[model samples]
Target: MNSDTRPLPQFAHAPLLLLIIAFLMMQPLSTDLYLASLPTLSSDFKVPLSTVQLTLSLFVIGFGSAQLVIGPLSDRYGRRPVLLWGLALYAVGSVLCGLAPSIELLILARFLQAVGCCSAVMIARAIVRDAYDPVHSVKVIARASTWLSLAPLLAPILGSYLQVAFGWRAAFAVHTLLSVSLLLLTFLRLPETNLHKNPGATNFAGLSHSFRLVLGSREFWAYALPGALSYGSIFAFISGASIVLIQVLHVPTAYFGYCFAIGVSGYLSGTLVCRRLLSRLGATATFRIGSAISLGAGTLFLAAVLAGFAHWSVMVAAMFLTLSAHGINFPIGQSGAVSPFPRQAGTAAGLMGALSMLVAFIVGSIVGATHNGTLYPLGLVVCALGLSIFAATRLLAPAEAAA
Candidate 1:
């Protein structure tokens, strides 16, 4: 669809809004619900803490890898059918995760769940890009991000309560219901948004050419790579936060939710702030500024830990700042990277998301592997990503940032 032809939507179309919002909400739910189960899942699996951690890493890996394949397919086919299939797969995976008798089985099931979940999220971003320009797209994504951000923030608390009440398996049961309902909603209400579809037009060569164009652009990577790293940093926390909160600080199990809620507020704040600023500073400049704060926060977090003054409260505060920084960085990076590629919004969103997941996998693997009951390594890596983003933007120069 031509950008000029599609007028900006003002939330009147509840069906379309629900379509994307439903998909968007699942991510946070997945992260949050699953995260709370981490501690209990280890004992249930009869596996080492590190191995249980692998489940989270693999979920991200499956989630990221699947996006590249599904995004392009949706672009070729249609959004509704792809979303339907993916959600169904996710539901099946959820059932498997809930019923699994072994840690190995649980890990495998989580991977499957993630693989199926990838389609909705990737398509959500592409759908926005398909319908709106960079500015409007930023706002839409930021608005959606609040729902997404809350998932991880609230997930642990929710997961913790569910784990305490029933068992780790019950959490998956809840996920299964949500996934099924979304699937039914899709069959009943979903619509076509792929304005760029043409079976005969975009052959293999056209597909290759579009990807090549994305790769050859310095700005795409300039925005994408750093954004990916920022998430990598966040993954470090995702993988390690439970350890720091529950294991190290010896916080009451029930109180873990409170800490997670506090950090989540930062993300919510960033989302609200970005909406106000996207029109003024634009995605590029706003993203650069956010990157600086992320980097700065990471460094300060590292120093505090090294000085032997860092505690759970201190780390929680640092995390809040960094999460907020991510809130701002993600919407801008997402909108900016895809802004230059309107025709292939699905493909573009898929590729950017894939890069992000890959980065997160790498960082998460490192943090998970070398965990030593300290946040030093994780904090350092997050700071490094922030700096890299800042450096990349400086080198690319604002004039050429969106190249």
Candidate 2:
């Protein structure tokens, strides 16, 4: 249990681990808990499906863009203050989202919420990099993900019930409650992990140099891009699944969460498996395995969809497989990206997060725009992402070997 030891002085490993889980889980909680409400939002707002879809794409864009600032700020000012302010903003944004009267307002609120959420996410990864060496950080991330999986696993089920009983607004209410609670917990329990704060990290000249160093690294892209592409495939499903299942395949809205849960089970399973794989195979080998799985799953999904298998079961099965791969790749990609730059871990983590969210925004928007009452758009987008993941894996192999 070696640690970098820059964390809160008196904090025990157990409590710190729980805090990490809480911080990282915010990402899934923010999105998954409200997913079941998407179609309802479309109908209630009298907007086209694509218009409603902006709530997601716009959220992703904000999430990505905010990290560019939040990461550097954390490096300059330390993670604690940045994180505290971000949580406060998230709480306010969540309340606004719940009360939004129009679809436009809801999208705006979601974007604001995303900016706040990015701070928790990027800082969590930066904390891991700060506390542990590379291999240990990967294992810690996998362990944390084991618990983090619970959010996506349960949130949709909870959300569907909320959507049915209390309407779509209930989901945002939950977000508001969770954000405030987490904010209190963070203020009380979390400590500043960025002890070696860089005074110039947020300055224009310094920020540009940090960007060039992180982006210029072959190792960062080698590890980061697969996770980003894998996440893009998952976002494709998230963006399109409700329309495909509820509208085209005709699954009942009430049962949609159960279907989603079943698919998320694959991710849970992958996280559990990731822990074992890391112990036996290490990060590089395990990452390769995950990449191959994504390629196969994506190819199969597109093939099945193109061959006219429009059943909800087919889509769910593909979701399961692709997400399983993501569960395996994400932690490793995230950790590996930041491992090289100990002094600049915050900047590196933020940049890596920005890349993934940017990919999600692009993939999600394309899925929305190309929707035509069929599974074609989802299938095409997912398969393309899978191919991209495979390419990234190949590109990263040499870099990993060199390291």
**Quick one: best lDDT, which candidate?**
2
**Model 2 spans > 4 angstroms off:** 1-14, 399-403
* Candidate 2 steric clashes: 0
Name the 10 consecutive residues with the lowest summed lDDT in model 2.
1-10
Report lDDT per candidate.
Answer: 0.77, 0.87
- Evaluate residue 271 in candidate 2 and report its C-alpha lDDT on the 0 to 100 scale: 89
For every candidate, C-alpha RMSD to the true structure in Å: 3.0, 2.1
- Candidate 2 at residue 325, lDDT? 92
lDDT digits (tens) for residues 1-403 of candidate 1: 3332232464234365456767877766776676766777777666778898878888889999887778778778877788889999999999998899898888899899888889888888877876555556777777778767767767778887887788788889998999999899888866677766846324787678778877677767767777777677677777777777888777766777778778777888888887777767877778878888887878888778778865778768887888888888887777777877777677777888899989888888888777777767767776777777667666765465555
Q: What is the lDDT of residue 327 in candidate 2?
A: 91
| Candidate 2 lDDT by residue in tens digits, 222-328 | 88888888888888888888788888899888888889889888888888888889888888889888988898998999999879898999988999999899899
Clashing pairs in 1: 28-151, 32-155
Q: List TM-scores for all candidates, in order.
A: 0.93, 0.96
